[model samples]
Target chain A: MFAGGGKTVFYPKKCPRVRPAPCEFPIIGVPTGEPLCTIPSGYRPNRKCTYMDYAIETNHLSKNYGQVCAVDSVDLHVQPGEIYGFLGLNGAGKTTTIRALLGMIRPSSGSVQVLGQPVGPNGRGPWRRIGHMVESPAAYPELTVLENLEIARRLQGVTDKNATLRVIEQLGIAAYRNRKAGTLSTGNFHRLGLARALLHQPELLILDEPASGLDPAGVVEIRELITRLAREQGLTVFMSSHILTEVDRIATRIGVIHKGRLIEELEADKLIEIRARRLEIKTRDLAAAQCVLSEAGYAVSANEDKLSTGDQRAIDAPEEVATLLVNAGTPPTRLAVEQENLEDYFLRLTGETI
Target chain B: MNTFIASFWAESLKVRRSLITLATAGGFMLLPIVGGLFMIILKDPENAKNLGLISTKAQLVGGVADWPSHFGILKTGMAIAGFILFSIITSWVFGREFADHTVKELLALPTPRTVIVASKFVIIGLWVLLLSILIFAAGLIAGWLVDIPGWSSALLWSSFGSYMLIVGLTYMLMPVAALIASIGRGYLLPLGWTFLAMALAQILGVLGWGEWFPWTVPGLLSELTGPSVEALGIHSYMVVFLTFVVGLSATIIWWRSADQSR
Candidate 1:
């Protein structure tokens, strides 16, 4: 179904993968297993690639168990091939919502369409194009890595043997190919899990806690893999993470769920934008600036030498800050606007006071 | 069929590549061979009171026509093989998928939940069939190595069919056990429940109570006897079929409903 008014029908033929990252940022270290290109070079940022955007769509989908509303009438739309991050404290219904979308649990209200098909109305046929890791590394400890991939390949009707190997190597678990999965460490086991999901070369992938108990390196490994799934492979990813840092880095769009309710939703960039603008303007004479701005009807607060105001709606902030400082008898020497990041922005949106 | 076929191929490859299936099969064969040798050396032919001794004597010698008891060591040997190897196969039939996390991959492959689970049933069923063949091969080897002159080809085939039926029915427990395991997230829950059911059925059989517990009916309807025995008939067959239906139905239902990750 073509979405009217600038909604292009998503298809493999019509859309190609849009590279998200041009170079690996030094902010986080990545594992040596696979080099996931979070931002590939030569990507046109304005291109339309829904397969790389909102590959998963849920419309007013809800699930209720007696009185518990696991997921309440939520509308989730993810861009094609973007790593959509989901966050909430435990029992916020992240897992429940995920399970519902994957057809694990039947929803009590509304509809869920994955890859543009009803998740429950039909059976698992549409799932062929999707690969999901629900809780842990969905792996068999007894089976070797190759054996696991064999099972995954057959299920996906994946014909090319070489392509499967490519995913395995890309996930960087090729060294553990012959070892029993049970013997691998939790981190390596997760790598194998990633390999299994990618073995099918699915258009959409879902991961729940892809880096739960990992050491620093393991976390890096999973994060990079998630980034690659979206940016390099051109696969849409719906991932749930407790660590906001990871979410902040990988997510193109984000949904904050609390007590089974999606309290907020926005583009990740917007969150950064809003956060980067919150500032505390401290002058030598804070009381005078507060009086001057208070008389001028500006959002200026006074505590000691600081007059904090994160308002960007003012016509001229420098002139007002100068005038307030000059009138307060406190010279405007430290009149600066500090940048707030994603974390601060989120806290503010969620009504969290710091 | 395409999904079923793919799942089958995938499940089969997994079992074949794993050492558990091979190791379990080898272990079952060794138990009879190693245990039977010691029994033959220690047991006294003069003491007819000792059933174990009589079975051992029957195992060592080639004189089945002049056997000392109604049955022989073969029943015990076959039983051991059935329980051990059959359990191993059954355990993997369902448990391995969850254990290996292949279930997630399989469930996401777009096959119907029933078909996904049914493919496992089919794979385990075929594995049980392969195990049955292996059991017959082992029995034939035992027969060749130890003399059972009166053990006719008809008796061997009859015994084979009975044992095959027993092993096959035992596989019904696989899906049920798997469902329980998946639900419980541990191996002990399914095996413990299955074993308890088996023990209870044996107690009921001794008491001659409530028809037959689902557990014993498979053993009774299946091939658990000396070479020469009559068919279990339509009544026994119906009971066994019902057991299979229930086991498979439970697995499919649980599989479709249970947390896909678990």
Candidate 2:
């Protein structure tokens, strides 16, 4: 079962009823008339499908450094085939959470389970099936790109001799294969990091900032590669990034973390509906528009050169707003409804302004 | 075993590509070359003085010019120089991971951290062993080239046995350097520890307690202070062995349990 939009949507195995009937359970994010208990036609069961719960799961996980709370009581659940975008500003404990998930750091409290195995006590976990790039890319500077990945392949216990070449090609780093890792550019360096992470065809990938240090084209290329891998190979990705636009573009599920706490978790599509929308009317006389909207029971505020309102009436019927403004001798020059973007939503939730 | 092999291969590649390997080899080779130079100076002091090799006040450099003296120089040099050089090798092998920020890559791999640490130790061991061999082999060639009088095979085998024992004792102390490198997460701390250990060894040897101290025991075994029969006992070797065990265990445990934020 998966939780989305404050409602639990059961997968096929979790549904109590055998026959397909109208879902008695409340449906929030699921489309109307869509079968609640049927698997998608393209869904193929893999080794990770046996877990059927979460690719990564954490409950009230917390970590501290002396008196400073690095990560506090954070809960995360990332389903298989879902691209979970962990969004936060710098020093927001995004890396701490990733470290805990990878068993690189022990949690001060609570537990973490990855690939259905508990993490830590002694850095023990299902690491063989998980690939990760923490903080930044790192490699033996003396080794070539091919040599670095070859070492990674061997350390990962991958027997296939061609795994290194496969990931190198997959990541479009074939051109720099023989070049020493220390000499690569930042974008190619990040590609090498991703190549190492993807070398073993891991079931889950935990990347700290997958698109960081890449040009716009490189970012788009990586985005397409990740999306393709997730769709075609059923790989789960848990990535943390401050780049809201990149997350907005690719993440199936978004988790916004602020000051070490996970403030919000929501499906990407549902974000479009949940984010606040407002109607803005730019008129010759902003004061007159504000007065008219306020008098008509529409809560309005003057913002710069425009009168903005969150009133449903104004948003649902923009022509009515235009007519009222026209009749009030403050005819609208421009009027449109604008939905808040992820960045705005994040800032607003965190009580920050940009 | 398979994981160990893979980790060993990875570690070997890192060492093979590093300039430190060549640098340490060259550094260790200096001991034999200097010893050879000292032998040439000792063999003909007046001629050496005429050639401006030694000052008039520095005419005597202890023992007579012979194979025993050359082998003695090699043994004592291994005891002293080997401590510094082997510590450097150990520090580089362990500390470079943290310095390069590649420790994180090793931490979460299928090959257990223990195996990786073991592979690092093994690489350091093999590297230092090779350097010791180079010093001994070069010392033999230098002795033959200088034409020192004493060339008895019996004395050569006995000196060789004692030289190897000193090398082993010096090698045993390196795990402490490894441990310090791991805990400090870089090269500086272990190198600092090495210098401290050397100072303490010198001070303790002067204070007449060298036999009990692990750092000083290797020097005593080399008979640099005096004859090993009078300077050391069974307890000295035991202390060095204990230091090795403690350092190796602590390093492995630290790698296994510590929070690797890097």
How much is B58 displaced in model 1, in angstroms? 10
lDDT tens readout by residue for model 1, B1-262 = 3878877776777677778777777866674464334333334344433666655655454333321211234444445455646665666666765665555555555656677677667776776677557656765555455443455666666656655656665665566676677676556677777667767755654554313455565544432322212434566556667877776777777776654534
For A1-354, candidate 2 gives per-residue lDDT tens digits of 343444333232223222223223332122223333443444334422332356788999999999999899999988766899999998899999999998888899989988777888465887788899998899998899999999999999999999898899888899999999999998899999999999988878999988887899889988998888877666788999998889988899999999999999999888889899999889888887888888888999888988888999889999998898888888999999999877788889888877
lDDT of 1 by residue, A1-354 (tens): 122244433444223333222322211111222333233345455344443224677878788888888888888887655679997766778888888788877788887777766776225436767787887776666677877776677667777877667877888888888888778888888888878777767877888888887899988878887786566566778998766778988888889887777888878877665554534666665676677777777787665667667667432366666665676676666666667665665665666666
Clashing residue pairs in candidate 2 (N, C-alpha, C atoms within 3 angstroms): none
lDDT to native, each model: 0.64, 0.84
C-alpha lDDT of residue A153 in model 2: 91
On the 0 to 100 scale, the lDDT of residue A304 in model 2 is: 91
Docking class of 1: acceptable
- Model 2 residue B146 CA deviation (Å) reads 1.4
Q: State model 2's lDDT.
A: 0.84
Q: List residue ranges in candidate 2 displaced over 4 A.
A: A1-52, B50-61, B225-229
- Model 2: per-residue Cα lDDT at residue A165: 89
Poorest stretch of ten by lDDT in candidate 2 chain A: A12-21
Q: Give lDDT: candidate 1, residue A11.
A: 46
